[model samples]
Target: MAAKEKLSGNIIQRSAIFLENIGKRFAAGIEELGYVMVLFVECVYWVLTGFRRKQPVRVAAVFKEVREIGVNALLIVSVLCLAVGVMLSIQGIATLKQFGQELWVVDLVAQSVTREFAPLIVGILVAGRSGSAITARIGTMNESQELDALRVIGINPVRHLAAPVLVGMMISVPLLTIVGDFMGIMGSALFTGTEIDMPLDVYIQRTFEALKPDDIHQGLIKASVFAIIIALVGVSNGFQVGSGAEGVGRSTTRSVVLSISCIVVADMIFTYFLNIGTLT
Candidate 1:
């Protein structure tokens, strides 16, 4: 029994040591991440500077990413928006009806969908779809030594790859949010029509009547911030990718996860600020 106790104690000690080592590695990694973030910011800064100088025109690349990221992301955005609209309308109607405030369903659905769900869902979809693809593409390029070749040839990788994606996302995410808001309203109208005997036109009219300027402004603002986060996180993870195929996969996954996480956190911050403003 004593020997078994000693053995267990030794195992526990080794586990604690291993955990401490992991903690140290994680702390070091976080410190390295700060440096990497600074580098990425500098890269973006220089890319913008070069654009001002016209060393390479950024228009075509921006257009390409808009087409690739925004256009390619439509189906997922549509599906998610539809689901969100349907769920919110159904739940909103059910809850409000129980309180004899069913007419507020339009207001509730429109406000929630337009002001938050639309941008949030679109951001998540874009992060998972477009952002992951961008990460994978960059990771593949890095792994294939294309980035090294660009460096040898005096081409800037950030200007060539990251900037275009960043600019594209800045354009694409807001456009996508607009599309999603429209789709969500349509979905909500359809659901309300079926569930509450309201005509689609009436539901839409009521929804629009309930929407305020802040709703639209906040949603757009969130989309813009989310776009920046998606680009930065995606490109950062991509640039950090290791040499193997698995590294590319991991980087892509991390990009999506980080982008989504950032979006959520940003959304919370926006929500707090907006709510505070509303109260005032």
Candidate 2:
């Protein structure tokens, strides 16, 4: 009887500890979210009002970062989107073939690429690529006390470092999504042309017929939101980095994971709201 009573107490204690840990993590997550919002507002303020300040945002610096973050990433993004497009065409044909609807693969590829896959792929790519880079750069500066040096020189880190990144991401991601959408649709068209002997013109006409302006615009809107999420998450994680190289490494990993997770969640929210809007 005593043994059973002691076991019951242990189980109760373990359950209590588990609940406590969960509550602590929930609180931390909320606090971190607040910090990210503050950082985003600061970054936005600097971008919008920097021209009126004594020290305007340097055009050369912003442009340099844009080239580094956006131009350098283009080839890889293009290749991945092309591959995804081809795969989608192949699988779509296979699935719809049983129903004598293999031709519907054109519609599938066009709508899915324009409305969903292209933006999502670009968002994830940027989150993994530029997001980690931003975190590691800022984190390295933190370790070397460069952030402090900038502060001592009367420069805000968010204005000097993060705003440029945010601008670049916002500009580049939507353009990338557009490019990805085109490449993805073209890939599908090419695959269908070769595999099923469908003429390229017919496939393109079918694709154009299947997609509407709203479908394309939805992807652009999603890409814009994803850019903000990726940039803020990356910059926020970088600012939160601890001391040393190990800290930078950990922060970079966290930035990628957090940015991707946030992008997915934001995408879900956008989808829900957009669906409601469409229904109404």
Lowest lDDT 10-residue stretch of candidate 2: 54-63
- Please write out the lDDT profile of model 1 over residues 89-153, one tens digit for every residue: 88998899889887788898788887899999999988988899989999999999999998898
Q: What is the Cα-based lDDT of residue 106 in candidate 2?
A: 89
Candidate 1 off by > 4 Å: 1-19, 32-36, 52-54
Q: Per-residue lDDT tens digits of candidate 2, residues 134-220?
A: 999999998899999999999999999988888888888998999899989988988999999999899888888999998899899
Top-scoring candidate (lDDT): 2
* C-alpha TM-score for every candidate: 0.89, 0.95
Number of the top-ranking candidate, with TM-score as the measure: 2
- Model 1 residue 205 lDDT score: 82
| Model 2, position 145: C-alpha lDDT score | 92
- Candidate 2: segments with Cα more than 4 A from true spot: 277-280
